[model samples]
Target: METDLVIVGGGPAGLSAAITATSYGADVILIEESFSLGGQLRQQTQLHANLPSKFFAERGTSLVKRLTSQLETPNLKILRNHTMIGAYKNGHIGVTNGKTTFEIEAKKNIIASGAAENAWIFPGWTLPGVMTAGAAQILLNREFVYPGKQVMMIGSNSFALEVVKQLYECGISVQAIVEASETILSRDQALLSMCKKNNIPFFLNSTIESVSGSGHVEKMTIRTSEGMMEELEVDLICTANGFSPILEAFQIMSCDLTHSEVLGGWLPTYSVNFQTSNPSVYLAGNAAGITSLGSILLTGEIAALSALESLQFISERDSNRKKAALWEELYQIETFFNKDTMLARLELVKHYHSERGLPLPDFVDPLKGEMLFG
Candidate 1:
């Protein structure tokens, strides 16, 4: 198949990019690995402080609905139950829908592939009842299948808290939430309050010493803050250590990447507009790095616009003007619930601007993490 743009992933970012590209008169083919389109958005059930959350608590599901409704243009083609397998030379992409593999010749590629949940491994983690917090979330929210009668979570970040909330809503019980770190990175009071209301105990400065079970996880040992070990009996163990960008496309393209724990592990250094080192490829959303959902949408739109411009599907002048316009529009569209996340935007821009030989933006007092232009 030959198209002006080949987008991988059918999440919010991929859908947004496809919509924007087709609106600009570019032919688009969007491929998603799942049977449905929403990606992780389908599992999420929290209200962020972003623009969309102002109107709805279930913003991810809502965005999925809104984006799909707008993707009715004739120039767009969507392939579900499909995933990109490789990126060959000369802008060719290899994709598969399980039974068959096909090649696509594209002028430009947008990798809104998003992120993958990170599970910090522990003994007995391979047991049947042990899973990632994300797995637990999907089991309850999407699959409508409960993980276990009683679950123990091994992380206390916002994501973990969200999973715990969903578990409660699913009529399941969470035994405890454990964090090895000494401090909680996210300070969302609303999330904390929800945990309190649910009576889910949050344990910090603690680590799961080991998990033991014959067929499924039945019990685990946790080292508490006081260096005392406590044994908890639980049927399911869910770990949500963190997330890393899903960089299969980058790996296929052999793009230069770096490992940044702060930026969510090995990822390509994204230019201000989320361009990877490879000229023909670009990244957006969690694929570049973790940020707010609103910010992810902005990057997706911007990346689509950039990709279209690279293919001469849109002129440079028009792209530059639109990008300038989007910069202001981005602030209006995105909202940060935690004040600390505001600095992530700064770090993304400043580092990339310097890499591109553009003037670097100025720094805030490093609150939790920077300077940027007004």
Candidate 2:
């Protein structure tokens, strides 16, 4: 397959870019690995703050439907269940449709492959009923199934909170919400107060020591400060350490990446136009940096316009100021949410391949504990 623009992921970033670029008369090909096209947004429970009011509290599945419908342009060709396994020089890409390899030549490439959820393993994490909070959300939203009747959340971050919220909406009970940190992180003080008023048990400065059950998770042992231990009887455990970027494409492309604790370990440096060190390639969405959908859309549109400009299709002007305003709006959201600190702590981890002379994480048993990223 060949196209003027090849988008590597069909999330909000790639989908938005495809619609905008195609409307500008560019032929576009969008590739998504999953059977569907929404990416992580399809797994979310609630839309976060700072977005348009209409999108507030919208469900992930609903968002995917709306965006997918808006993006069905005549010039856009979408390849669902297609995965890009390798990238080559001179704007060539290698993709797979599960059984066959397809080579694509592109005038410009945009990577919106996005990020992945991180799994922090502890005792009994390999149990059949154990999963990440985001994974649990995927089960509920995508499969219309619950992990179990009762769930014990292992973290108190936004994802974990959303899992609890969604599970409640699904008529499942959350036994407890445990936070290893000393305090819960939240931008909305009212939400925290509501949690307290609802009598939901919040354990701070605590950690899950182990999980145990006959064949599935039935109980979790949590160790708290003051040398106290508590066994919570729950049918499922949801570990929520947070998210990290999907960097396989960056590694294959040989782009220079660094471990920025603020950007979730490995990330590539790109200009405002989303151009990587390679002029023919661009990046957007969480692949550039973990952020909200509003920011992701703005970055994607800017990248599309920049690519058009490079091809002598669009001219730069003061009208571009709209992007700057969008950036500032996202800046306020980030500031209010305190994402900088969390991102700062995440910079401690990095990704490296054997030939790159960078040390990768030691996976004792990859299949048992590994998290897949595209």
Candidate 3:
């Protein structure tokens, strides 16, 4: 197959990119490994804060619906159940649908392949009743099946808190929330208040030493902050350590990568426009970095606009103006919800530009009235 643009992943970011590219008269092919789009958005049951809007909120499902509704144009080709196996430097993409393998030759490609959940390794972690928090979420929210009667969460970040909230709403018992840090990692005060209101027990500065059961998880040994070991009986164990970007295709394409703990792990080095070292390739959404949903959506559009500008489908001047507006909106969202991450991104951009012997743009720190670079 030959196309103007090929998008990997049919999640929110890829969908946004496809819609934007197709609207601008680009023939696009979107490939997804799943039978349907939406990706993790389908499993999300909580309300997400809208971009640059303090009072407005939208559910993930609603956002998915809104995006998918706009993809009826003939310029867009949907390839569900197809996985992108290889991305080559020569603009050839290898894809397979379990039965047949094929290749696509594209002028430009956008990788919004998203992120994978990180595993928290422990003794007996491979037991049948032990699973990731994401798995537990899909079972509870999407499949309407309860994972267990008593659950122990291994992390206390935003993702873990959201899943805990859902588990509570479903009338399941959360035995305790265990965090290796000294305090809860989640910055959401509202969720923290909910945990307090419900009298949920939290084990801070703690680690699960081991879990044991004959056929499944039956009990766990936790080392508390006081250096005392405590044993708890639980039917299920959900680990929500964190997530890392899925960079298999990016590595295959040999895009320059850098490590940033704030950005969720190893990610491609790209400009503010989301163009990577490989000019023909771009990245968006979680593939770029783990960030707010609103910012992730904007990245897709920005990357699409950059690709369109390269193809001369859109004028560079017009693309710059649109991208500027998108960047401002993204900054606003990140400043509100992810100030530290936004600062880290600015630093990363500066480093990328400096390493290439390019002039660094002047950057002002949002939190402090000070110049970061000149």
Candidate 4:
């Protein structure tokens, strides 16, 4: 079959893009790899203790329901339990459901495959009980299952801390959160207080030397900054070093990609419009870079608008107006959560500026987002 737009994910970006594109009069087909629609959204829950249930995670759940209902639109078709394998010649896409593979032609495509958890490989990481913090999250939140009785986390970022809270709630004891950095990031301060109050120790300037078990992870050896090894018993060693965008399909599409350790590894170097080096393929949401749900939603809309306009499905004037309005919404969600990301953002800007032969900026306005060139 053929469509004007094919969105390759069912998460915040893909869903929002589908909704916007159909509203703007483009026929859309959404392909989700999961059996259900919601993407990374299904994995999130309460972000902070201060916020009520109406915040990011809960709001995302509600959005999934609302957006799913909108799929009743005649122009929008959904294909679940299906995935696009690759691109065919002449704007056609190879889609498969394992047993059967077929092709669908589309004028435009938005890849919103989202982010994958970073694998911080160390000794014994391949142990049976070892898992990423994201996996632990899915087990407890979605499946109502306990990941482990006792766990120790490596990588003392906010994401890992959030999992620590959930582990406590689920009655899974978190031994300690280990950080290679000298201190926990400021963004994690709020939850750090909560964790300390609950008696979860924070290990600074520490790293896991190794884990040991016969068939499953049973204990770990941690190396402190003083070069002393501390051994502790834990059923699971969870890695929470953050995430990288799932960019394999984009790579297959031959989009220009750049490595940014700050942005979560190799991400498509798409322009502001989310257009990749390949003119027909676009990126949205975590597939571009990790950010808030609000930013992902706005980017989805912007990408859909660009796709619609590129296909001549929407008027150029309407496209420009819609994109400008959506970008303003995106800019509002732009805030540096920690110093590392902030510096990385600056580094990214410098790299791009160097690519374009422009002078590196002296300072970027944190609040106003103004760039003063050096």
CA lDDT of every candidate: 0.77, 0.72, 0.87, 0.77
Write the residue-wise lDDT of candidate 1 on 246-285 in tens digits.
9878889776787666667888876655677777788878
Report the poorest 10 consecutive residues by lDDT, candidate 1: 361-370
Which pairs, if any, clash in model 3? none
Measure candidate 3: CA RMSD: 2.4
Cα lDDT tens digits for candidate 4, 1-374: 88888899999789888988998778898999889888866767754122212234344456677768877799998999998888777657788989899987888889999999989888998998899988988888778888899999888777888888878887888899999999885366667888879988888999889999999998899999899999999998889878889987887688888887767888887654677778889888888777666667777888888888888878878777766666544554544333344344445545655576755322223312432321
Looking at model 3, report the run of 10 residues with the lowest lDDT sum: 362-371
Per residue, candidate 2 scores C-alpha lDDT tens digits across 205-299 of 98889999999988889998655899888897888887777889877777677667656677876654567766778887778777666667656
Highest lDDT model number: 3
**Residue 260 lDDT, candidate 2, scale 0-100:** 70
Native-to-model Cα distance after best TM-score fit, residue 247 in candidate 4, in Å: 1.5
For candidate 2, the C-alpha RMSD (Å) to the true structure equals 9.2
In Å, residue 292's CA in model 1 sits off its true spot by 2.1
What does the lDDT come to for candidate 4? 0.77
lDDT of each residue in 205-261, candidate 3, tens digit only:
999999999999999999999999999999999999788889998987778999999
Superior by lDDT: candidate 1 or candidate 2: 1
- Top TM-score: which candidate number? 3
Off by over 4 Å in 4: 47-59, 336-369
Q: Give stretches of model 1 more than 4 Å off.
A: 52-58, 329-374
